[model samples]
Target: MIDLVCNVSNAVKAVDPKAKVYINIGGAVNLLYNDRLLGCIDGVLREELRSHPGPSGPEPQDPWETPAVLDTLAYSHSHGKTVLVGSRDRLKGARSLCVRAWSHGFIPVPQPAWTLGCSTPPRQFGAVAPQWLKATSKSIIRRPYTSIQYLSLFDIL
Candidate 1:
């Protein structure tokens, strides 16, 4: 994960060396709520969306974290930075984050609803059948499943 963060930070630094990039280093949601860290971040890339269920099947963290994440989001937006929340569930926390981000002049980018593994193919709408359409469509359609699997595979690392 340090490598991943470094990669992203390095890429951003390469493009705009003055840009300050902050990475959250806990489980997905924990990273979402740390205001002190968020306060320093010029932009955020929230990579995972699901709340991890504890031994009892409820979230392991305090429920208050949700609001804290919102607070961090609001702060990021007020700073006029970009906040990209990547998640499998569009309705989970994405809607509120986007609404708040846009209200504060932050650019909000969301992952598509079919961003997680689902058996059904996504509906595609286009004016014409472009070259490599079939390959591109298949790749796009398979992304969620592939991504989920890829993330899971990293757990062993």
Candidate 2:
């Protein structure tokens, strides 16, 4: 999978170096966190993984605070990738996550409502996302790569 992602990224970059390729391995759906797998990707294909390392899981350790999560943040930042964090709404300490992310030089991007939680009472579906992105990007980021390409397909751009 790492090779595939790298190869595809290399091929695309050959054609359009300006194009950004963001990676999100979502979750392993296994009995473990698969840190080694992510480490491998970061070790060899770190440059290809952009914007952020996407976090997903309902594990005991919230994705926002886990070692894997923090490591990815540092690794991505070191590689000059914009750090975007998508915290699960079900995860505890959301406000804390936001503060920690800000302190670590991360911009909090909205997770699709489906991933956050479809059952909860929806609030501020449209207004808050753009405001949050614009405010954080302007305040913290020197060069925000939280691009509209991903959101455009979903009609959220």
Q: Top TM-score: which candidate number?
A: 2
lDDT per residue for candidate 2 within 105-132, as digits (tens), equals 6554434434443222224332133342
Distance from true location, Cα of 54 in model 1, Å:
5.9
Models 1 onward score TM values of 0.38, 0.46
Candidate with maximal lDDT? 1
List residue ranges in candidate 2 displaced over 4 A: 27-59, 62-65, 90-95, 113-157
| C-alpha local distance difference test of each model | 0.44, 0.41
The local distance difference test score of model 2 is: 0.41
- Write model 1 residue lDDT over 1-157, tens digit each, in one string: 4445556556655765655554432345444345544444556555443354456543533577556665665666566545544443354655654554345544333345344221222223112222221232211122354321221213313
- The RMSD of every model to the true structure, in order and in angstroms, is 9.2, 11.3
